[model samples]
Target: MSDIKIYSGSSQVRVMEIKNILENEGIEYQEVNKMDSSYAGIFGEIQLFVSEADAEKAIQLVETIKNK
Candidate 1:
């Protein structure tokens, strides 16, 4: 179950939304902390990752959200 990123960004609201959706669907995911350490996430990217097996599914989920 190698980890792969399904989404990356600094949008807290958007990221949380997708995370909630993933959680509801029972998909396991990892959150990679890419935020700047000095400012504590002032200007950096956050990544949402899932297993390779769930990559496609995750992407689809994200796309569905995007379409909404």
Candidate 2:
């Protein structure tokens, strides 16, 4: 049961939106904050991962949200 990365970006708002979407759809996810603590909001990307079994559906959900 490997995890597949479904989204990665520097926008906190967008990241939160994606997390909500995934939650609403009952998709489990793992989030990784890769930002430099010193720079915080100004640097790095937030990554979201889902199980490989759910990767396709998770990606489609993410894309739909992003297109809005």
Candidate 3:
């Protein structure tokens, strides 16, 4: 079986919010930082990851928040 899928968000706060939503829904996920040294002096993007199966649900949740 394949491991869960992962996504990359743009900011730490966004990643954390997504994580909390996933946790509340009892979904498992992994978060990884895609930052590199070239971005050290500048603002770096953060990533919010979830399993491929959960991708739709995660996106829906975020969309809901955005719509609100």
On lDDT, the leading prediction is 2
Off by over 4 Å in 2: none
Task: Flag the better candidate by lDDT, 2 or 3.
Answer: 2
Per-residue CA lDDT of model 1 for 6-67, tens digit only, reads 99888878899999999999999999878887865478988999999989999999999989
Which run of 10 residues does model 3 get worst, by summed lDDT? Answer: 1-10
Worst 10 contiguous positions by lDDT, candidate 1: 33-42
TM-score for every candidate vs. truth? 0.85, 0.92, 0.64
Which residue pairs in candidate 1 collide?
none
Backbone clashes in model 3: 2
lDDT of 2 by residue, 1-68 (tens): 89999999888899999999899989999999998889978889899999999999999998898888
Q: State the C-alpha lDDT per candidate.
A: 0.90, 0.93, 0.68
Can you write out model 3's per-residue Cα lDDT over 38-68, one digit (the tens) per residue?
7642455556667777777877887876576
lDDT of 2: 0.93
lDDT of 3 at 56: 79
